[model samples]
Target: MARLIATAEDFAFGPAGKLVTVAEELAARGHALTFAGSGTALQLAERADCWDEVVACPTDAPEFEELVGSRMAAADLLVSCVDRPSVELARKHGLPVAWLDPLTWWWGDEAPVWLPDLELCVVQRSIGAGDAAGPYQELPANHVVVGPIVRTGPERRGDAGSGPLLVNFGGGEAADWYQPGRDTNYPYVIIDLLLTQIDLTGFSQVVVASGERIAAEARRRWPDAPVSFECLGHRDFVERLSSAQAFLTVPGLEAPLEGWAAGVPTLFLPPSNSSQYVQLDEFRRRGVGDLSVHLRDFLPPLDLLSAPLRDRSERFIEQLRDFERTPTIRTEVAARLSDLLTHPEGWMPAVRRGHAYLDELGRDGLERCVAAICALVEREGESA
Candidate 1:
């Protein structure tokens, strides 16, 4: 058995979830694994039990580099979720690294000197075509375009019935900027807006599967609403998503991909990051999902706040304020949601297109990824 270290920036569940899936598969195949990340990544690594040790390697921590270096020194190989520091550190230790990039957004921009030995990109062919005519085209030593690394849930029972509208906006602590501090908090602004403009008589149930704090805040805001707030574990979250009839979320890769895998239509909110914006744009271009509504359309502009919001980019803040101030924004958003829920058939074209792409990509990406990692390990043994 070979010892491997897997690392990612402690951003959200997407990176950590992918690493957990790979680590679990490798562990089941008789490999020793350690997971090093921050925030939700560390939390998930511990809960999943896919790693021998779960290390808190936050980027801002003073001894982050020392901790990562110490772990890499003991491992025969490294598999990372496309972090430059981890990749460089693994190379410094002369360990082969497999970089798993689920978004495929890491073009050859400002890359580190020591690239990964294998670059496994989890995206559709059109996204990972590598057709950029320049040095960027041939960036990695071994570039492989794999399917989306989605977490599978139990076979959904036929009697699950029409599930609630599953809502999630990635993981990690919610930013305070989005919080209005009224009765509603950040991230649930849309829910509050919908509540004001629409009767919600047509919909039976709404579920928000974010963290406990968000769920608690949601309940505090709308105590009488039919919405149920839950902070589920990874497996349960996927199960809920699979049985859900529709989705309302930030346009991140994992949640949208899960929604597509389940063949449900999603109504997206404006993205919180540049990578998400790009990916969501691609989804719109490909007719995989509907275009997201601007944040201003759902709530009052951020500039109206007396003080600057923390933990948000100035550019995003500016964009949020850039929308034309209009009194009918809530009515417009309500109309859009009404159309989406009442006439679900209008969304079938996009839903079918997304499912078809997922079908062609196949669901055995984790198996293929495991095989590739094992091959790399065997090759190192042969060389030794």
Candidate 2:
């Protein structure tokens, strides 16, 4: 069995939850796995039975480096979600590491630079980082393009609201990060504008998932709005996505990926003239969902393709949104992911052969890309 140490050390939402899910799956396969980190990660590690050892670092322990070094030496494989002290420690010990790809508009210079250094970089195929970075194409060839490994088994049952618009914009250890940016002309900004333009009386509920300050502000502004707010675990969040009608947000890689998985139709707001727009284009090509330039642009396209959902309640709307993100490719990604785990030498051939649609898209075009995603998802279900 491949002994693994899951590094749940990121502050962001991308990888921490995914790492826990991967650890559980790996443990079910009988691999020895441990979790090491501080802050909220300590709490998560405590609840997980998959972990062989939970190394808790003090809030500000000076000997943290030495402690992490010792832990890294103990494990043969260090599968990480976050990249910080954990990435550096993995490097010092020469352990294979898996880092999540985060490429949104807000990312700084460091995002692309650090990802390449890891022994294996597991990225969302949607991020397009595989094509952008020379390291993915040139260097040690450790990049593994796995769809974000999410919890898909079951969800807590909740009666979803039909007319109510559930806006979930925050979930993580700290809720303060998803602050509404007034200046950025992103989807969040566009969402705010559309909410105001529409008749408030038409919608039954306006649920907002966010920090206390933003939630409070939303409630105050729309006092008559039937708004409910609560913190949700990962499973609950996925269940909510499964039940929602339509999603409005910046065309982020993660949200769209989740929306696609649930088959929920979405309206993506991309920065003008960005390559990021390509992600949404692929979603549209698959008949997965729609996109808009702004609120006004949305009305016409939505009126044309989404008559069934046009005047529906939030519950009905959410149902309409569930349009099958990319079919279901969990198995193919997992198979490829497992191949990398079991046979290290096989990485280059699979990547070079453009395993699945990645290669087809490279040779063919957008149509091939869509076919690849569909094939990947169906094949995963078959294998499972």
Candidate 3:
């Protein structure tokens, strides 16, 4: 059995989930798997029950490079999800490295300085193709767009007509990144504002899945609003998404891809950052989801007593005000929500298009990825 070191960015749910899926598949194939990444990655690895060992190594840690370099020296191959440290370490050790980048957001001049030996892109085309230059322009030659890396889970019954409306703003990582030092209640605030405008008479239930902090806040805010506030694991999260009737979430790559796979149309809220804004725009352009609606357009300014939180809120409002300077594109966010809720069937065309795209691209992404890893490992063994 080959010894494989898998690493990924662990701050968010998507990368951790994808890494766990890869680790599980490789472990099941009898390969020895060791995972090195952030605390989120460790948590996901523990949940997946695959890794022989897990090391919590945040990307920005001072010793992260040295730690990953040591691991790379012992591993037969490296599989990574946006873990640049691991890729750099692999390059130093001359080890084969495969990058499974689901977001495909790292391209053009913004691409990582050190390219992986193999790039498994999750999108059909590399982003910013026109701006790519020199050696970076040839980077896509090694890219294999395998679509979104969706993990297999317990078969879920499709309840598109009656399933719960899933509301998620992503995991606690996003909260920590977007509104540090504040109670993670921004998503609940968005939901509260949305409920004021949209009529949810047709939906059977509303479920809000996020971090414990957000869940607790949701429970407190919507004590009697016909909503369930519970944080679910990755498998259960996907199962829920698979059976969901609709999704209301921040514009993230994983949730939308899962929603598309489940045939659930999503209404995207304004992104918390510029990266999310880019991904959201791509989703809208692909007709996979609605364009982002700024939260400020639907809700008034937030009042926070916490100094850090208040400062963040003020900055956010300023950014929103600047973004809304263009009058022609500015509309009431509530209007879009109302339109989505009133005519859920209107999204079916987009859903069909997205599904067709997935089908054409092939849905057996994990298998293909596993096969590629095995092939790389075999080739390495032969070279040895």
TM for every model, in the order presented, reads 0.79, 0.53, 0.76
Model 1 clash pairs? 179-186
lDDT of 2 by residue, 278-364 (tens): 344544454333333322222222221122222222332222222112222222322322232233243233222322333332322
TM-score of 1: 0.79
Candidate 3 per-residue C-alpha lDDT over 232-269 given as tens digits, one digit per residue, 9 for 90 to 100: 77667877887777777777656766666666666677
- In the range 1-384, model 1's lDDT, one tens digit per residue, is 998988765555667767777787899999999877766666667667667887776644668768877777777788887555677666667777877776444343344444444433333233433335523254455666566676444433322245567777666342322332431233555666666754455445777766555667778878887678776666667777766666777777577777776666667766554345455656665666563564544654443212222323444544533322344654576566666666666555766787776765567666677888888888886786
| Rank order (by lDDT, best first) | 3, 1, 2
Off by over 4 Å in 2: 1-3, 8-11, 31-63, 66-69, 102-118, 129-139, 147-164, 171-206, 211-225, 269-289, 292-384
Better of 1 and 2 by lDDT: 1
**Model 1, runs deviating above 4 Å:** 65-68, 106-108, 116-139, 151-161, 172-186, 198-204, 211-213, 216-225, 291-314, 321-327, 360-364
Error of 1 at 109 (Å): 1.8
Q: After superposition, how far is residue 272 of candidate 2 from its true place, in Å?
A: 14
Collision pairs in model 3: none
Q: Which candidate is the best by lDDT?
A: 3
